[model samples]
Target: MPDDCRNIYKTCRKAAGLTQEAAAERLGISVESLRAYETGQRVPPNEVVELMVILYNAQHLAFQHLRETNALYSSVVPEVRPRSVLEASAKLTNRIFLFAESHADRRLLRITEDNVIDASERAEFNAIMEDLQEIVEAALELRCARESS
Candidate 1:
């Protein structure tokens, strides 16, 4: 309910890999209505939210499948000088810790509905940071091993 449901809806739709027109059709809504939601001119009804959840779930599954396949292929034909998992994870953990600590001072001002959205954003950001950390560590480890040879 925070940060403009319309914008959130639109983002979720895109994240689910749905074109505006396709999402509109699936939701039994007009393209104009979908556009309005994306443009922050209108909020979707609860029914639309339910539909979006379904769409997002589907998209997440597809993404997981793709990721797994890529990982499998990479294992067989690894990249040169890639970071190791441990190094990347440690880096991301440190970054998130710093960010959370820095933002701690502003927590008092972040009250109300906007705060909820901000919190969600922070969580998503942290997740991404952790992922990047893992990637970088893997790459670093790979690079070190190559150099040692």
Candidate 2:
């Protein structure tokens, strides 16, 4: 996926080699509706987005859709960059290795050993959470890569 694209919906549709009419027809929506979505004049519903995901064979778009539409979801869901399956797998493995080297498991255990996150441990706890999120993002990317294949 090109990072410069203004809209994932538009980008994916183009990547799928779909004209607006064809994509709209396949998605069971009108061309105007799809144009509205692509132009960001309206948010596509989850179901329509799901259809696009299947039609485009682009799973990452689902997450990107949610993140783009919902503020809370956007805060929680990591932005998964599109990559080849091999790249995704390598990224996931690298994340796991980095997490292990950080000894986050031991740190987490200590932080929760007393069922409380002490002020001193807060920074480390947050850092560990970030590492965990990176792992999750990589996993999602791998899944997306497989679907795209």
lDDT of each: 0.54, 0.89
Q: Pick by TM-score: which candidate is best?
A: 2
Candidate 2, residues 1-149, lDDT tens digits: the string is: 22443378998999999999999999999999999888777888999999999999888888888877778997988998899999999999999999999889898998989998889999999999999999999999999998898
Which is the leading candidate under lDDT?
2
Q: Could you estimate the TM-score for every candidate?
A: 0.36, 0.92
Per-residue lDDT tens digits of candidate 1, residues 111-149? 333535465567655555554455554554444433322
RMSD of 1: 17.2
Off by over 4 Å in 1: 1-6, 58-149
RMSDs, each prediction?
A: 17.2, 2.5
TM for candidate 1 is 0.36
- Name the runs in model 2 displaced over 4 angstroms: 1-6
